[model samples]
Target: MSERASVPKEAEETESEPEQEPVTTGAQSVIRALENAGTDYVFGVQGGAIMPVYDALYDSDINHVTMAHEQGASHAADAYGVVTGDPGVCFATSGPGATNLVTGIADANMDSDPVIALTGQVPTEFVGNDAFQETDTVGITQPITKESYFAADSDTVGDDVSEAFALADAGRQGPTLVDLPKDVTQGETEVEPGRPETPETYEVPEEADDEDVQEAVEALAEADRPVILSGGGVIKANASSALREFAKEYEIPVITTMPGIGSFPEDHELSLEWAGMHGTGYANMAISNTDCMLAIGTRFDDRLTGGVDSFAPDAEVIHVDIDPAEISKNVYADYPLIGDARNVLRQLFDAMPRAPDADEWRDQCQTWKDEYPMDYDTPDDEPLKPQYVVEQFSEMTPDDTIVCTGVGQHQMWASQFWEYTEPRTWVSSHGLGTMGYGVPAAIGAKLAAPDQEVVCFDGDGSFLMTVQGLSVAVREQLDITYVVLNNEAVGMVRQWQDGFYEGRRMASEYPWIPQFDKLAEAFGARGFTLESYDNVEETIQEARDYDGPSVIDAHIDPGENVFPMVPSGGDNGLFALNEDQLDMI
Candidate 1:
């Protein structure tokens, strides 16, 4: 037979045999990697460049939630991580989708939350060519993310995603990003159907040098008025129990930062609640007057320090944290211990003797707490007070209900009024102070603990920022109670304008006020408008009993401001209290 014709039909069939189904594509690898990493949920929105990954997601076991906006998805992911103590996963398409996530990513970064952000990029050929929907995600997220990765080839998809998760959940947890090109996602490759090699484990040192422990112990022993200043790190490290035990062992008063509100039980006898700007007068007073201050996991940011030169001027400071860079970056530490909060606290507790008698100091702090106890009174005829509403809500909600807040006056009020008995129950954008974070974060919190009630305390301005999230909540049928404290203004900015800008309202006031109840109804959620405080409790109960999402628009005092406020950069002693309440303190 002629050589060309002699090719066996069987040989031709063998050569043309359909190629084995690809073991994996870049997209499939990404999804499988996440599944291997134990990711239960992913919050994101689909788009052109990311369609391939979304297609892969459709077949995966992971639960995917499509949010109204990328920012909402990011915040939702942020809360998921905060509540679960795992890296929350978020995906976004290129360009505007990626850019919209910046604020939420920055929020995670500032607060040290472990969030994994995955963004789609244009094909490799178009990466630098300014193609449609193309942007340098790695470059854009560099400053905000703990680490950033770009998967230039299909082979790196799994490795890059695995590394991003590892980095996000590792020491000093923060957001991490992985950028995947469209072509890569569409490319086929043979990938093992198993988890990647486990990343190196980070263990907090169990023991501190004897001398360092002695130094800290001696500092505590010598000081009559000792205080423990806790921060978000306590919660992040899952060391709230350790912190409480340490405080009890030392009989030291514990004051937390705003982000650390629930780190220590507010109802604890030793608890000084929160300190720094908008902190209780007593907590700030204790920080300013302590003879020895042991700050753990706190960066002592300008907010906490107020006037750095004047902060804890009289106190000998012992700062402990995992990151050495934060040890003395802002406030100088007399003794710096670099280690994990839980591990270090455990060691310190074991090393130290029982705290010396400091009854007089303790009593003095108690007196301050009594004198300036958080209080707000509302006249029967006066418009409903936001503080009262929060107090009632706090009282009525389940003890473990997760409370999330949008930024501004409502945030400070929630921090002050709500009694957070558990860690991770209080969620908010502390560092970035991003508005419109509450609703979506609450959604994430609800998803994290489906049985737990998730309530969002949002302001009029803040609720408007992400009101569209209501549609998602309704679609998912999440039983979330959103309380809008409607003052019809950017209350916090207006407060500042009133206090510092000679009452120039400027752009702080909202020209048009949308009926939040109507808006909620339009979004297919139950709605209630409370113009009076007479039935506040009843309304809350009704909303709580409702089987799905509900919005309660409670008209609050427009002029009310957060009290015991220390002017920015001003000493704690410069607290501005209501005129009528000043004498009580």
Candidate 2:
């Protein structure tokens, strides 16, 4: 669990008492339902339509962090959910406030992160009259949420929220929303909601079928070059320990998807890091060469598999997932074991008779790692390398420090260079590739794990999109380090324009971008700048030493590009190390 939700001692002691229920408004009932669920914190912005709920919150115990924007609130809640297994909660008013949460909701849906969004609606009578600050929020969000609710009655509003909360953290966890109308919230209600529970139709598979497990074990027993592929699902299911034990017992090498970066310690002898576009070359090589692949908790998205037909061409795949619909949806699963990751891995471990003899295969993998090392040159005269900065931070922080990033070259560099030793320590936007996620995510991670150090790596363009988040960090007195790899442009887009679009950079460059360090200072947070390697160590140390929020605007080489590239729809086995190699291919 991220942060364990706990009821008050007074409530726990009075659990068996049957006192008379007090008369309460629907808004008060809503707050009562959250109290029942033991919600620790909620991130949201106040608005006119949601005043009733806010008024009720005035006396409630839940810690509500007021964000600068609805989008930031949603992102913060999303990150909170990512860190903890429980669903993070957020609120927004009708119309624009509700609509602003769309990106974060869509992001959570795509990444399968658990979050609950409560959106206020116009009064029921005025809902369809094109009333001010009203929109068909349910209609707009239905496709993005695991489930959505339109609360029409004051008597059942609390129950509606309870059900929505249950569904958000239930099977294949994702975002769920509750649309509360003003009239319903303002109405009177005496009944309180019961404990949260999913509807009867919902069922979670605990373990795979016996026949499927037997078949998978037989395949593994007969394999020569076997590999274990771990995805974000492993982290979500809290099955990293089971996965590690299974891999080690079977003497199989492990590769991770980007979102699965922290599932296995990157420094482990058997670890090949992650595989996909811009993934480590050794990991991609292992994925291509394996004869039998045991993949767990992954949907095998296109970015990870590249060309579906070519991905793991020589491997007979045994895919394990809780959601049956995802089985064989992308890469064909030779053996489909449908169940929870931890349970299924436990079954596989018990059923397997002996480990495979892949000594030669393991040696070959080590050779590949040596052949394509993740190294870069740093001449003293050249501008600061982003990779060096990432490595420096990685070396400076503890192994368990939480890292967040925005989508761009900086994100890739952070993921590639950092050595992750624990699960839930790597937080970022994946699947949806949402930019401007670093700042708010860092704030949420700090709240989720108050003792752990939190750091965010962002690019200039991405940082500019959500710089307003700095004010919230300062206000909260959160200890977080924000590192911006300012390349004077949208680095990733510019890199792509240079490589794939005949070098015609259109609106990707931002030469007039403001200095982020000064901007952080203006927001009442500590700030520092890095022009070269001369001050890299001292600058980073000063930022880390600060007791409150800080930003390091480290200007980097504009010409630097992310390599180990697999052009869209290309085979993962044939990734290039540079643009020149890409052109030659």
Candidate 3:
């Protein structure tokens, strides 16, 4: 053969037979886009339809954390976003897998946490044919997600991820869904040269209007007893520094919501140090007595407001939130500012004169502080109290420690009891009240804030839901403290049965929970039991001093119910088990 012909054939053979740099697949394109967006980790369960994304993750640089359930993965992603101020990613497939994620997506929507959800769909041709493992995921999640879309080809996968991230991190951040058809997973594509095409613009957080700022400042200046009610929005809007300055400059007192734990440092003189279902007596009393209240980033949940009529009735309300819909939704605000709390404070500080009653208002708030301080009498009885364990745990950890808790009595107790002195110090899924959230979320929180001490305040009932994750911490060798408030029952259910359901004693009773200390030991974690009230503090100190993950099980009274709970339809001071009703019970 001629030399030229041989050269051409040899080159063709080399191209066709020999290996070269791997060509990009649809899944690779998607993963590359995720990496570009700065995704630190992805939470998901392995599934057939979505395996391509999982496979891509192996080659790319993104970290994947396996979860027992898709719902847990979604919740963990949302919680991670809340703590880090960045969007978190979760993956699942179509049909049951996608359907299972509805609750979590809705929970993120309700609380406005930024989460990006990726799901697989049936092949393009079979989309409407109702093929196996096929469900209309886009339609199903449209109502729940901030934005929803499905891509049929590999070329569009990158665009979908970029869009999902943008929607999640945009103003009033919420969950977003981008579903991919399985056929697209195998297709090849060359990404068009440059960066991912972000949406035309992201929703810049709502800024404070001049008029509202003036009005809010005027109210603060005119009031003799001004109070600042800090909520989750303060932290969400990144307004903690502004809030701190305003509180100090005006000498106004501060109260925080359960989710707003650390926005105002607990050590600050004006800080409420109140939390969750059971807040401090002084916090509640001050709410009713203050002449003016500046409510920021709070939803005014039933637990926070008690009865609508009695909540801050005596005070002139100044509500500020980024979401206009949240304005006047619950408590009627006398002066509602439909803008960002942080921005409004910024504008108010510049335009209005700073009030001069710092000493007087500070003195009155201190009086309430002395009256109903967060003091739990150390009972002489031998059995350990969870309250003592929580207090001691807070003392041992630094002020910036991150506390994540499971749902039920222990969650509310921790919210009411622990002193969170820094923004994002406490994390949980508040709206859905998912049981297994604490342990996995603590893992995610540690990932987000590696410098801070992470603790999980879990109840016996809730801890059992995701006890498998105890192994997760050990395998990763993460430094976290798990404090199990063991009351030996589904305490919240029992409370309702005992109080509202006429003590019928339904399925809420769990006579046997496997030995928790042994369970921890098996997971390669240090475990101990607090047998007496005398040992509670010392035991917690030991748990803190341990080198790795540890668990402290306190034998709290099975009968100790969360108090000051608002009955199904009752208002403030009209609860089934309140401070006033404690003596009678």
Worst 10 residues of 3 by lDDT: 1-10
After superposing candidate 3 on the true structure, give the runs of residues whose Cα lies further than 4 Å from its correct spot: 1-23, 192-198, 356-361, 545-547, 566-570, 573-585
lDDT of candidate 1 at residue 268, scale 0 to 100: 89
Clashing pairs in 1: none
**Candidate 3 accuracy as TM-score:** 0.90
Top lDDT model: 2
User: What would the per-residue lDDT of candidate 1 be over residues 465-499, giving only the tens digit for each residue?
Assistant: 99999999999999999999999999999988877
lDDT of 1 at 358: 78
Sorted on TM-score, best first, the list reads: 2, 1, 3
Error (Å) of candidate 2 at residue 321 is: 0.8
The superposed Cα distance between candidate 2 and the true structure at residue 98, in angstroms, equals 0.3
Per-candidate TM equals 0.94, 0.97, 0.90
Candidate 2: stretches off by over 4 Å: 1-23
Worst 10 residues of 1 by lDDT: 1-10
Clashing pairs in 3: none
lDDT of each: 0.86, 0.90, 0.77
Sorting all predicted structures by lDDT, with the top scorer first, yields 2, 1, 3
